[model samples]
Target: MEVIQVKNLSKNYGALQAVDRVSFAVPEGSVFGMLGPNGAGKTTTIECIIGLQKRSGGEVTVLGLDPAISRKELYGSIGVQLQETVYQDKAKVFELCQLFSSMYPDPLDYKLLLERFGLEAKTRTYLRNLSGGERQKVAIVLALIANPRLVVLDELTTGLDPQSRREMWAYIKELQAEGRTIFMTTHYMEEAAHLCDQVCIIDEGRIVALDTVDGVIENAGMDTMISFETQDEIGMVLEKLPGVNRVEQEHEQVRLYSQKEDVLTDLILLLREHAVEYRKINISRPGLEDAFLQLTGKEWKEKVS
Candidate 1:
């Protein structure tokens, strides 16, 4: 079942086109990721879906209801976490949850949510007293309080540290296991690669590539980077080797990057012909990061730390 459908979605601001004819469908009970760079119009596309921004052209439907006409009805079925959140400084954590829960017809257990997020200790704590990660956790709990069928999360792990981010990822998996659909946008490539069932890469307000994470990687038409240490001078035949894209040498180690998966076989043979040997070979597979660069023609390195 398709829970969300967007067709020929276009948004513009004066002479600048923010989003242009973007189209994609999110399946029910699946994690769909919208991946792109800072100015790629990702936020505009999401805002169009949630009815936060009106599009210049195109159509959007959430749960078979038009977002523009059925804005109130749609809110009950979908939860949202924006890129930034601000809480009332004087409000307690538990108090905010209660306030949000009352707005929905059927909300989840606030105490249970607090316990699940390890926020039980902070229930009575003032909103201003919580850390960044804790504040984000509270935002998530509020979004899920209505037990929405579809959740829209933007920059899901923005301010989190490595350990806390991973923990949140695991929690998202739990939501999927319970058959909840997730639609999200993020600058983090690894997060999209790790959690997305289907990915749509956008650039300059247009859709560039849409496929599964592995499919997107394969579509990049780029090869893996293979490196190893060798006492012998492998630079002698590096350019002459078949399936080699480029060659980089750093002292005793030579790194060969290629598009063909079997490039290593040919490389090993070439080494033997030259009577050169290497040790501790390492191959780095092409991932979402490479796909983003290929699709958008942008320079980006994953900031995992």
Candidate 2:
């Protein structure tokens, strides 16, 4: 079953169209990801789906009901963690958790959530006193407090440290194991590649590609990259080899891109034929980031750290 369906969705701000006829579906019990560069309408599209922003045109349904009309009911079944969250500075951690729990008919154990997020000791601490990472974890705990069947996370690990980021990833996997649907927007391509079952790449308010991680990479026509440091100036010679698409040489370093699986063997034979000595050789396959760059012609600016 599809937990979320969006068809020809569009959102405009005066003369500018932020989301242009975007269509996609999030399957139940699967992790769906929306990816794009900054200001490419990722956030706008998400806001429209969750009823936080009104769309200019198109249809949106969340868990079988129209989000714009059934927002109150939808909120009970869906938990959302937006990219940015603000709270009363004077409020304590436990106080905010209790407040959010009151709004749901069946809330999870907030204390257990705090402990899992490593914030149990900070329950009595004021929100203003917590670190940025701690505050972000609090937002996540509140989003899950409703025991929602569908969870929407925008930039889930933006403010987290490396360890906390891994922990959150594990928790997301746990959610999926329990048969929950997850829809998320993220600038981290590796995160999408690792966690998402399906990904939609949007550029200039339009979807450029939508597929599984490997499918996107394959469809982008991206090839395996082989690079090495070679003292021999064998320029343009590797390009003549079968399966080699492109060859680049820079000072004593060479990079080759190939589409065929036998390219490595052919490359070795060619190198031996020319007696070209190479070192520090490395081979890497195209990933989500490579596909995004190929389709959008733009760099992913967000650093995972």
Q: Pick the candidate with the highest TM-score.
A: 2
List where candidate 1 sits over 4 angstroms from the true fold: 233-251, 269-275, 301-305
lDDT of 2 by residue, 77-103 (tens): 899998877678899999999999999
Local distance difference test, per candidate?
0.88, 0.90
Q: In candidate 2, how many Å is residue 44 off?
A: 1.5
Candidate 1 has an lDDT of: 0.88
lDDT digits (tens) for residues 1-305 of candidate 1: 99999999999999999999999999999999998877789888888998888889999999999887888899987898987766897999999999989989999999999999999999999999988788888988999998999999988787688888888899889889999999998778888888999999998998899999999989888778999989877675887777787998889889888888788889888888888878989999988887788777887754322
Candidate 1 clashing pairs?
223-258, 223-259
Q: Work out the TM-score per prediction.
A: 0.90, 0.91
Q: In order, how many clashes per candidate?
A: 2, 0
Candidate 2 weakest ten by summed lDDT: 296-305
